[model samples]
Target: MAGNRAWILKSRPEGLPDMSNFELRDIGAEPLEDGWIRVENKWLSVDPYMRGRMNDVKSYVPPFALGEPMQGGAVGKVVESRSPHFEVGETVFHMLGWRESAAGPASAFNKLPQMPVEDHQWLGNLGLTGATAYFGLLRVAEAKEGDIVFVSAAAGAVGSAVVQIAKAKGMTVIGSAGGADKCAWVRELGADAAIDYKDGPVVKSLLAAAPKGIDVYFDNVGGDHLDAAFAAARQNARFAICGMIENYNAGPPPAFRYIMRVIAARIMMKGFIYTDYMAEMGDFYRDMGGWVASGAVTGRETIHEGIETAPDAFLGLFKGENMGKMLVRL
Candidate 1:
């Protein structure tokens, strides 16, 4: 039998996490249960949202249990199955991540939908990241044709998608990223303008990009980005609150000085998770698939090799080390 290895949560984080908080353990492979499948994990996703799950705070999802295997998004192929819904050699997406192999109930896994893309795309543009951009921009923000749309983390996975989707929908898109290289990539992704927040004051750069103010804001990195959007929002503008990566490791929520603008501008803001729109997956695939096929939307990724490098891949997220989706290829 093949040996198995998993990354265990050794301790809760204090501000920022470190290698000491995680433990890589070798364990005996347990037999598959009657209604479960055993999968050889091929790809593991390390997203910004996973940071919240490490804290012992109450949120939409439960925190990671101490001394247990960590979980995120993973793609794998079933090697053995005791469930009718799955078969040997079938590729799947599951939440049992940070491990080389996994055995879980059939309900915990979903077969990857057929797409003219690579398998790892399931953890990037075709997965949660894409969904976050699609629904947040189109539904939550109510962005429409000719609307001025602004997205933060514009070269990252969800932000890049937002840049493209808004442009494809006829909206003038302005994206904010860290450096000149990322900003240039955002423009290449079809954003009308790309703001390099590292250059000067974020608000000043954003105002320069959209002089008339913006109608929709797709927020990925909160904090200064949120304040910038608030400062540059036009009347009746809508904001979709996605991942707040900036504040993930902070002690408390950022005190935005421009929050008062919400009342004066009547800026509509709503926080959301990708799971909130699961029923619309079919609609998402139809539109996103078409866009992908026509080169209207592109999924980019930053991948690290081996399951052992999963921790580094995850830590790189906060450091802005990833270009698009950050994944570990096992």
Candidate 2:
């Protein structure tokens, strides 16, 4: 029997994770079992949410067990199948990531739909990241035509999608990113204004960009970004709180000096996870899929080659190393 290589959690990270927290080892593959399929992972997604799962605390998703392979999103090809639902050579998307291969029940994998986009995109655009942007902006934030929408981390996967979608919907878009290049990319994505947050205070930059105030905020990076959103929100504005990458690593929460603006402005702020709108995924695919095909929405990826570099890819998320989705190709 051949061996499989997998990354196992060596220890729980205290603050920022390091290579020391992970261990890669070779283990023998189990014999094929009935009602199961074995898949060779081709691409794995490394996202900000995975940082929360690293903690040894209870949350929406269970924590990764010590000395075990951590789970994530992966796109793979089935090599062996004992289940009628899947066949050899078929491509599938599953949650058993961070390893070279996975063998599990057919129900654990979703057959990928044939699309013009690349297969790895199933882990990003047209997948979780895209869905998060669609639901957060259109549904949760209740963004509408002529609304001025501000998105933090505007060069990231979810935030980039939000900017493009808002533009397509006849909304005025204001985006904030860390560097001049990222800000330019935001503008190229159809943002009415792009603020380089590295220049100065985010609140000042946002206020300057949208002097009339903003009607919607798609928050991907919290901290000063959240405080800036509150300060820039117009009366009766809507805020869709998505991932808070700013505070993902263990640190003291940002002191929000503008929180009182939420009350005074009567802003409606709500936090959401994409799974909460799974019932509406079909709608998202129908809309976002068309936009992507028509070039109205652009999807980008930063791929880290080889499974051995997965730890660096995941760590890169905190360093603003990726402009879009961060992925590891096995």
Candidate 3:
């Protein structure tokens, strides 16, 4: 009588998504096909990028179909395997999420290697969020030691990782968060200063935090934060355009007032996806793994229990409800 519990896209959200847009359904067991495996997801990722997939629009990834189970990032166990590539009890990271269980071709999953970290850590510091921070700061932004780096959403998942990694690499980091507590946490992550964006205008606070101007900017919240970065950028500053959580639910707003500064400051801003570095996975694992083991970096998480709570966790990303990576423990 056991069935897989899943959250389906009942309808496309108009402005801000609500519970009405999601429906919990039961996916009954199905016969396994050759070269396929059945996985029971343990940890599900709730990210800002998933918001774009809710709308029926052209993007880096396809939109979630109506009345179908949604997908994001998930790490699970192989409960049943009909493929040589995967074995029963093996841990795997896959794209099939927003559900308790899924049966798919073995090629759809990556068999996780034996690691000293927790199983969920593969979904956090060693996962997409961590990789995003790593590539964005080091590769995209070309951040180096002695650089003054500014990161928005510094207490959130990717931003927090950028703060820690930048500090560990000997760069002076300034982080901005929405609240006093979140700002304090950013400071604890080794940022030279933490700007509380809610306290006043981000530009004013950022200018005060780094009077000399920042050599690099890692952006998460785009609207005012991007404006602040442009105003506070040093000559030839580099920017890694990460997520724009502000405009995710809201339609694209007008360009930043300081948009013209890109030419004035000779800034180089680039947007990138983590998958673009698939060839460097080994390099990422080695460096990030050592940093994690040496305590030079840490992964923080805010978890919601059960598959039914997944929608709420996803919804919480825009509301600033999570300190680090928001995850659902199924």
Report, for every candidate in turn, its global Cα lDDT versus the true structure: 0.91, 0.91, 0.92
Tens-digit lDDT track for model 2 on 141-215? 999999999999999988999999999999999999999999999999999999998899999999999999999
lDDT of 1 by residue, 1-330 (tens): 468999999999988899999999986588788999999999999988889999998999999999999999999999999999999999999999999998989999999887878888888778888888999999899899999999999999999999989989999999999998898899889988988888998999999889999999998888899999999999999999998888888866678889999999999999998899999999988998889889899878898999889999999999999998898999
Candidate 3 wrongly placed segments (more than 4 Å): none
Ten contiguous residues with the weakest lDDT in model 2: 25-34
Could you tell me every candidate's TM-score relative to the true structure? Answer: 0.98, 0.97, 0.98
Worst 10 residues of 3 by lDDT: 250-259
Task: Rank all candidate structures by their lDDT, best first, as comma-separated numbers.
Answer: 3, 2, 1
Q: By summed lDDT, which 10 consecutive residues of candidate 1 come out lowest? A: 245-254
Model 1 steric clash pairs: none
Which segments of candidate 1 are over 4 A away from where they belong? Answer: none
Candidate 2 to native Cα RMSD, angstroms: 1.1
Model 2 TM-score, 2 decimals:
0.97
Better of 1 and 3 by lDDT: 3
